[model samples]
Target: MRKLTLLIPILVIALIGVLSSVFVVDEREKALVLQFGQIKAVKEDPGLSFKIPLIQEVVKYDDRILSLDTETIEVTPSDDRRLVVDAFTRYRISDVVQFRQAVGVGGVRVAEDRLGSILNSQIREVLGADQVTSDTILSEDRRELMNRIRNQARDSARSLGIEVVDVRLKQTNLPEQNLNATFARMRAEREREAADEIARGNEAAQRVRALADRTVVETMSEAEREAQVIRGEADAKRNGIFAEAFGADPEFFAFYRSLQAYEKALQGSNSSMVMTPDSEFFDYLKSDRAAK
Candidate 1:
């Protein structure tokens, strides 16, 4: 019984040592075996790994792609216009050993902080170039600018064991204080355009109205000429008829003319004449044909 008790204690200690020496590295993780705070081995593959009992420790880091949102920053472009910029990056640890060596015990958080600084610096450099303008940053050319930033950051982050996969601008906006001013300027531009259109429309309307007035004047003149011609033709025809009657019978024509004169002189009931009876105006009234 005494020997069994001693064997049981030994077995228990052996079991604890075995359990502490064996470690696991999940498929989504990378591990570093540290002995006395010094890296001894790196485990990148999944399944099982081993470390010394009690003296060695394992530090695991995520192997998947990670994202970091950079702090919002303000930059000035070549045009002297300022913009507020926000961006994000996708990255992964390319060399865990290098990462551990660079970041030490601070781990992924320290690496991220350093990466953020690199991204911001590169962003400021690319955006502040003499040829880059605020319009370019807000336009499709922004994609090209982001690529440049990613390339620069990728090169810079290599010392930190970080591989920058992509970088993209999330927002590019005018500052809050500039929003109202920009809107006012836009409204003024629209108003000016509208005024120009109205002026053009008025000019066209005046031209059309002047043309209509000229057309009316021309039409009226043409109608007046036609009426004058008709009036002259009618007068000539009346005079020709009078001359034919006089040629056919002078005495009868004279009598008809005298009767027309009497009709005019006595057209009204109160019409009166003070002419002498022996006057030629009364010749037809006292002629011999009247007795017959």
Candidate 2:
């Protein structure tokens, strides 16, 4: 019974040791087997793997794409406009051995720190180039700038065993201190445009008014000239009729003139006239009396 008990305990310890020596690597993980703090093997493919029982170690890294969001950085374009830029990178470990050697067991965090610096430098270099203006940075062509940054950063990241898939500016904005000033300038520009439009409208209105006034003056002048011509023609026709009446019968014409004068002299109810007894004004009255 004592020997059996000792054998059973030995078998249990051996089983535990075997279990500790074996590890299963997931497909999403990349593993590095290290012996005495030195890399022994790199396992990229997913399967069951073996390591030394107590003296070896395995460090696993994600094989999938990783994201790194950099802190907001300030950059100045060629146009001399300062901007705050937030950027991000998509990357993966292309060489685990080199990555481990460069970062020295600090893991993804350390790699990201180094890569972030590289990306920031590339961003500044590309965005601050002589041909890159603020308008270009803010325009659709910004994609080209980002691609340039990615390519440039990729060259630098290779030393760190990093593959830069993409580099993008997540947000671009003016500094807080410049926001109010920029808005004020924009407001001033809008106001200037509005004033220009109003001035143009007023000029058009004045032109219309002047044209209408000129048209009205011309129309009134034409109407008055026609009225004068008609009045002159009517007066001439009346004068002709009067001359014909006088030529037809002088006595009747004289009587008609005297009758018109009496009508004018006695136009009011309280009318009065002072005249000599033998005045021509009484000729019509005397003729009427004689006829009676």
Candidate 3:
């Protein structure tokens, strides 16, 4: 009967012990104490804690950094070009008290939503100034844009008692419809340029060929005229030589001239001679034969 009574007291003490305290808090966590469903204290420390077990609840939160990926959204540049952008943000709780007061047991979903809204607004403003992005330009003034976003996020997160570590753009792309149109236009322009180049080349070739033909005709005509002049001069020289020889001795010149004429006029087997009385070819013949 005494042992049973001692056991009852020990059980009561064990139950009290179980209901009155908390285990050691992890070094990487922050805790919030709630009394009867009402928040009473925030504990940002590690190790064992004392609390009313049945009436107090301790909500723990991670003290490490967290990341949130924003949805891909369409943005327009200043030049009226539209593109899809995917972004992400990294943040951490700066004030345990404020996080507890504002977020309660929900952690940072609300906070993340609020930050996403702020980021979206700032991104819209930044992207509005970008019209068409150049393929060669990295991020297209993205550093300046990130700087603007960082400043905005700093101000925003500070107001929410959170610290923004970094925000980054993951991808940027043209919309499917826009890509199709852009590619088609580029193809058409390239084709037009190629055609123009071909036409210019053909024109140039025709000019060169026409000029070559003109040069050929001019050269051939000049050569033929020069040949005719040379031949005429040669004939005149030959005639002059003959005249000089004939004047040097009239009788001998007459005989040589008659032989040359006979050789030319009587070239065929069936031949006849006909001449005037004063003809040089008949000078070698008798005057009676000449008359006949």
Q: Candidates' TM-scores?
A: 0.87, 0.92, 0.68
Off by over 4 Å in 1: 249-292
Q: CA lDDT, every prediction?
A: 0.93, 0.92, 0.79
On a 0 to 1 TM-score scale, where does candidate 2 land against the true structure? Answer: 0.92
Which tens-of-lDDT digit does each residue in 32-150 have in candidate 1?
99999898999999988888898999999999999999999999999988899999999999999999999999999999999999999999999999899999998899999999999
By TM-score, the candidates rank as: 2, 1, 3
- What order do candidates take by lDDT, descending? 1, 2, 3
Candidate 1's TM-score: 0.87
Model 2 root-mean-square deviation: 2.1
Query: Which 10 successive residues of model 2 have the least lDDT summed?
Result: 283-292
lDDT of 2 by residue, 1-292 (tens): 9999899989999999999999989999999999998999999999999999999999999999999998888899988999899899999999999999999979898999999899989988998999898889899999999999999999999998999999999998989998899999999999999999999999999999999999999999999999999999999999899889999987788888888888878887888889888777777689664485
In TM-score terms, candidate 3 sits at 0.68
1 or 2: which has the higher lDDT?
1
Off-target runs (Cα >4 Å) in candidate 2 are 257-265, 273-282, 286-292
Which one is best on TM-score? 2
Best by lDDT: 1
